[model samples]
Each structure stands twice: as structure tokens, then as C-alpha cells.
Target: MRTAICSGSFDPITLGHLDVIRRAAACFDKVWVCVSPNAEKKNQLFTPEQKLRLVQAAVADLPNVEAELFPGLLADYAVDHGANVIVRGVRNATDFDVEYQMAIINRGIHPQLETMLLPASAEYQHFSSSMVREMIRYHQPLEKYLPASIIPLVRDMTERKGE
Candidate 1:
């Protein structure tokens, strides 16, 4: 079976992320959305467990999709998970540059693994987790950028920021 790893910090999974996961599901037998815990981002709104739960809830309908948390190198995690491919979503040129550099470095570490980039859907071309977080912080409606189910969670988190 062909398995692919979609690894990200997923501070809070947004619609753009769900879009990528849905698209990746169609192309791979199994698509694991691995949430990585970054030591550098300790102030992340969602804890690793919360991120995993959110991802699981978001993709629960997808039979071939699953979510999990992993710490350390993403390439190593992919190999350990038996994934031969890495799926990434690109929204623009800047994303391409960053993902491209990581892809090259990942390839150098694991030449057998391939990275596939899917262009973001037109509606979500400008959507990002950080943007969503910022919007929520400012009390801006995020109906367009986040799944309905996630809006409440994000709202609650952002509201707590002021307390």
C-alpha cells in the first residue's frame, strides 16, 4: 500500500490544511497527518494532543486518513511510519521556496522518499494557520478560513489570550 506523510506543526489545523489532506487522501492509500511538536514554538495555542484531536476530528470522515503526533525529524518519522512520500501544499512562491528547501534537505537525508506539492485551492490560496490565528485574535470572522467545527475552538483559544 502506498502511504504518504503530511507533516506540519498544525498549530491549529485550518481549512487550507483540510483541503490538502482531502486532496492527498485521493492520491495515496494512506495519508497520515503528522503533527510535529516544535520546541521553538512553545507558545502555540494548541497543545500537541489538542492538535491531534482537531486533526482527527477534521479528517474522521476520510477512511484512509489518520492523525498522530511525532517529535524529531520529519523525514525519520516518515520512514518509521512506512511512508515513502511527503505531501505538501503550496499557496504561493514564498511557500514554494521554503518547502523546496526542506524538500531538498529531506531528499538528501532520505533519497528514496519523494515530496509532492499540491497547489492550494483558489479559495484558500491566501489562508494560513498564522493568518487565521491573527484574525481570530482581532475578533475577525474566520468562517472562510476555518472549518465550522474548528471555529469554536479557535475562538475560545483566542478569547483566552486576553484574560
Candidate 2:
């Protein structure tokens, strides 16, 4: 079975992230929506637990996709999940620069693994997790950038954190 891993911090899974995950599902038999472990939880708007739950809830309907936590190198995570491809959603030239370098390093670490840089859909091309976080921070409208289910969860988490 061909499997892919879509790894990200996914502080809060934005619509763009979901778009990539959904697109990845169309190609790979199984897609792992793995959240990379970030030790700087305080800086993050949502805790790891929150992120996991959000990711799980967002992807629950995709029979071939799963949300997981991985703290190690992505290549190792791919190996653990038996994934041959890593799905990356590149929205612009800037994103390409970063993903390109990481793809090279990942290839060096695990020669057999491949990186698939999927372009963002036009509607979500300009949005990102950081942008969404900033919007949430400033109480900006998130109707276009975030999935409907995630908005409430972010609100609840922020309210609980007293933000």
C-alpha cells in the first residue's frame, strides 16, 4: 500500500492544512497527519493535546488519514509509519525555499523516502497557520482561513487559557 506522511506543527489545523491533507488522500492510500513535537508549548496558542484533538477531529472523516504525534526526525517518523512520501503544501516561493532545503536533508537522512510539494488551492494560497494565529490573536474574522469546527475549539481553548 502506498502511504504518505503530512507532518506539521498544526498549532491549529487551518483550512489550508486540511486542503493539503485532503489532496494528499486522493493520491496516497493512507496519509498520516503527524504533528511535530515542539517543546515551546507556551509560545503556541494551543497545547499539544489541543492540537492533537483538533487534528483528530478535523481528519476523522477521512478513512485513510490519521493524526499522530511524532517528536523525532520526520524521516524516522515516515519509517515508523511505513510511509514512502512526505506531503508538503507550498503556497509560494518563500515556502518553496524552506521546503526545498528540508526535502534535501530528509533525502539525505532517508534515501528511500520522497517529498511531495503540493501547491495550495487558490482560495487558501495566501493563508497559513501563523496568519490564522495572528488573526485569532487580534480577534479577526477566520471564516475564510480556518475550518468551521476548529474556530470554536480555538475560542474555547483561548477562553480557558484566559487569553
Q: Could you tell me every candidate's TM-score relative to the true structure?
A: 0.90, 0.94
Q: Candidate 2: lDDT over CA atoms?
A: 0.88
In terms of lDDT, which candidate is strongest? 2
Question: RMSD per prediction, one decimal?
Answer: 1.8, 1.6
Q: Candidate 2 — number of clashing residue pairs?
A: 0
Off by over 4 Å in 2: 39-42
Report lDDT (CA) for all predictions: 0.86, 0.88
Q: What are the per-residue Cα lDDT tens digits for candidate 1 across 1-163?
A: 9999998888788899999999999999999999998888655777788788778888989999999998889899899989989999999999999999999999999998899999999989977887776776678887887778777776666567661
Candidate 1 at 44: error in angstroms?
2.4
Point to the candidate with the largest TM-score.
2
lDDT for each residue of candidate 2 in 1-163, tens digit (9 for 90 to 100): 9999998999789999999999999998999988986775446888777899889988878999998887889999998889889999998999999999999999999999889999999998987787788888888887888788777888888878876
Off by over 4 Å in 1: 41-43, 156-163
RMSD of 1: 1.8
